[model samples]
Target: MPEITVVKVERVAGEQGQAGRVVHIERPEEWAACPECGVISTSVRQRRTTRPRDLPYGEEALHVRWHKRQFACKEALCSRKAFTESVAEIPPRARVTGRLCRAAARRVASGASVAAACREYRLGWPLTHRHFTALADAVLAEPEPVEVLGIDETRRGRARWRKNADGSWDKLERFETNFVDLSGTGGLLGQAAGRTGSAVEGWLDARGQAWKSAVQVVAIDPATCYRTAIRRALPHATIVVDHFHLIALANKAVTAVRQRVTRDQRGRRGRSVDPEWANRRRLLRARENLSQRAFTTMWNALIDHEPTGQILTAWIAKEDLRSLLACARQQQPRSVISHRLFRFFSWCAGSDIPELISLAETIEQWWPETLAFITTGITNARTEGTNRLIKDAARVAFGFRNLANQRRRVRLACTHQTINPAA
Candidate 1:
């Protein structure tokens, strides 16, 4: 076969000089075969001209025009009369060259929105979207095996409405469960309809026992639904409670105590001028991150002014909980963590704050999982990062009503690979 090259270049004659190059390319002299009878033919029945988009030449756009030859099939019994020539660079019947399609797909998969990719690539939305969908489908068809799975839920939209018993409308919270493979730079395994146990179990069960057996750990927030599903689907896998969720719970308890104490002491909700209200964010911040003198001054003032010591106690309890997590992450012995945790539990029990007591009990119930988290050093931080990307994509797209397409886009984005090479 002869080497093909650009044989001619012409300036497009128009009112304005367009920023592009129109290159006439030569076709390789190769024998064509009849598809029906597999007979080789050398006859050129006709020649046709076609212009297809190609990869940009520098900053300028590229237009590829090829004089494609049609060959006549010589086999007597062959049903086909003629067929057009195709090459790896430019497939048959395609409006764009293979390289251009790949470039567009790469741009879209690399975090650029379809509209942005289309604009930058000088392609229409429909064409760009087609390439993106094809790339996503090819790349995300069979997910990688998951060893450490992370399950979490995110609010996709507002609550759905349903007719109530009295003809009134009731709102039901809508959620989607994301299954992430945390064994590597996390890729989304799948997304289910809702955050229910059944939804999670169904998705897991579909992966079969081989996948379930391969899973070593499953990390999740302290959600009972997720616990139930993981227990049923991956019974052997250790469930590790995410440390961030534990800290969030502690913050919630602190907030609850503050609200209750404020209502009782101030006779109303806290105002901007109030010291505690003004330093609300300071109260939630980790002690290590806060300036010692500033934190001490605020702490002393808030505790001294309030007649009830509940606020101070709540703050201490919150700090103690944070300290417990910090200690768990340290290279200390397990006995040290156990001792500190016991102290934290005792403090919570004596604190007399209902919120703290409740939090302590919840922690006690999930103590094994918490300990597993400390030992295994696994968390849902990756899954949370993936969730943020999913939300960002949705925000950029002005929100997605079609869950299937949204899932595809997310899988493509998270995996950063093509599922189908043929596409």
Candidate 2:
């Protein structure tokens, strides 16, 4: 290998009665330069033998025996002592050769587990993983500036409840916030622990003002903390709330209204026989997904079984909100958006149902962000897809207990190195 500068392949043969091929190697007898004094050294200090592991060859593992030395400084005037020689492939104190690490890490980048790499290389887990990380550290690129960035969170660990001194239990939720490049090929930029505003701001602050200023828009869910952090860190960036989240909120409002109506009317939860329970999933579905017969069946059943029309009101409000969102795809004409928004507001206002009213208030609260979504039509779909890949990486390893290693593996998995490695 080019990484080995001084070593020569002296012999490659199977020893008597040995099972595998043994490759004996040694440094050439030449004057070596003194590392500190810049003088040549010829005095011999000591000699030792090392067997650094290398990539497997053929069916059996090849054994490498390297005969190396420590040389005494030839310069008398230098503050000279002795030092061991090293090559690029075998750094000082490295037991596993560099090329072996690259081969194992390449396997990992191609979806092989670290344990599988370890078995193939016949190396320890720590050494194999360190090599994997070294290759990744060399390969991972810097976060490039992008016009649009998407932010989302995923669970970092299992949820737990810790009891306080006063006998109250506090939830301990672990999460990691993922920042994605929405306008570029950088699938995942970076990740930060926790889902708090401080966590978001801390990561942004490290990117420096120049990087933050280049970001013109950010797509995210309707998390107040995320918005607060973005405003503090990127004041110029237009925040576009994902339209999917708003639709989910509308569905959530429908469910809340149905549950409240059922409890109030029957003084208990709805059973499977109840029309409200039967139509629960249908109410959350988009209008296009249901057939006319199915819709008619649900309508007749709910109308006949329930005297109060609260569930119907919530469903109508949901459809109105959907129609309003659909205007975003109509090129967001001002007149069209105003008409749709007015119609949705009129429906919510006419019903005066607490659930529908609350949904309207939420729409009004995030109206500017909603307008940004309509105008730009940028969604957090990329970030959502990246989150799936991230979760898949977690599953491939079963799970990760250490956050740092997990992030390394995830970053490697999400934005795998495409460029060929130099030998």
lDDT of 1 by residue, 100-192 (tens): 777787787777788887887778888888877887776667665778999999888777799988999977656889999888754877888
Leading candidate by lDDT: 2
lDDT of model number 1: 0.82
C-alpha local distance difference test of each model: 0.82, 0.85
Per-residue error (Å), model 2, residue 9 = 14
Clash list (residue pairs), candidate 1 = 138-419, 138-420, 139-418, 139-419, 139-420, 140-419
Clashes of 2: 0
The 10-residue segment with the lowest total lDDT in model 2? 3-12
Clashes in model 2: which pairs?
A: none
Deviation (Å) of 219 in candidate 2:
1.0
How far off is model 1, as Cα RMSD? 3.4
